[model samples]
Target: MEAPLVAALGALIAVVEACGAAVVVVGALSGGPARRARS
Candidate 1:
């Protein structure tokens, strides 16, 4: 019932947070290369 729905929502939130963290790491890693190329 409501419990299952809540659990699903929580799982979705965790996945979104993980994706955001990965993006940040990737952006930080690539940012250096991009800046060097521009310069």
Candidate 2:
């Protein structure tokens, strides 16, 4: 009962963190070239 709920919440948090990291990585990669070009 409680164990399953805790597991589910942990999984959800892990997924969200992974997604956030991916977005940050992608944003940095996409921004890098533009920033270099401007300079």
Candidate 3:
């Protein structure tokens, strides 16, 4: 039981970190274009 719980917690933490990285990448991409095209 404990092992399964630990695995689940670790997986959840990994997912959150991955999502945060993805969000940061997306924000940078969007901001770059918007800034460059600001006529």
- Most TM-score-accurate candidate: 2
TM-score of each: 0.83, 0.86, 0.82
Rank the models by TM-score, top first. 2, 1, 3
Mind giving the per-residue lDDT tens digits that candidate 3 earns over 1-39?
799999999999999999999999999999899999995
lDDT of 1 by residue, 2-36 (tens): 99999999999999999999999999999989999
Clashes counted in candidate 1 amount to: 0
Question: Can you write out model 2's per-residue Cα lDDT over 1-39, one digit (the tens) per residue?
Answer: 899999999999999999999999999999999899999
Computed on alpha carbons, the lDDT of every model, listed in order, comes to 0.97, 0.98, 0.97
List the candidate 2 regions with Cα displacement exceeding 4 Å.
none
lDDT head-to-head 2 vs 3, winner: 2
Worst 10 residues of 1 by lDDT: 27-36
The local lDDT score (0 to 100) that residue 10 gets in candidate 2 is 100
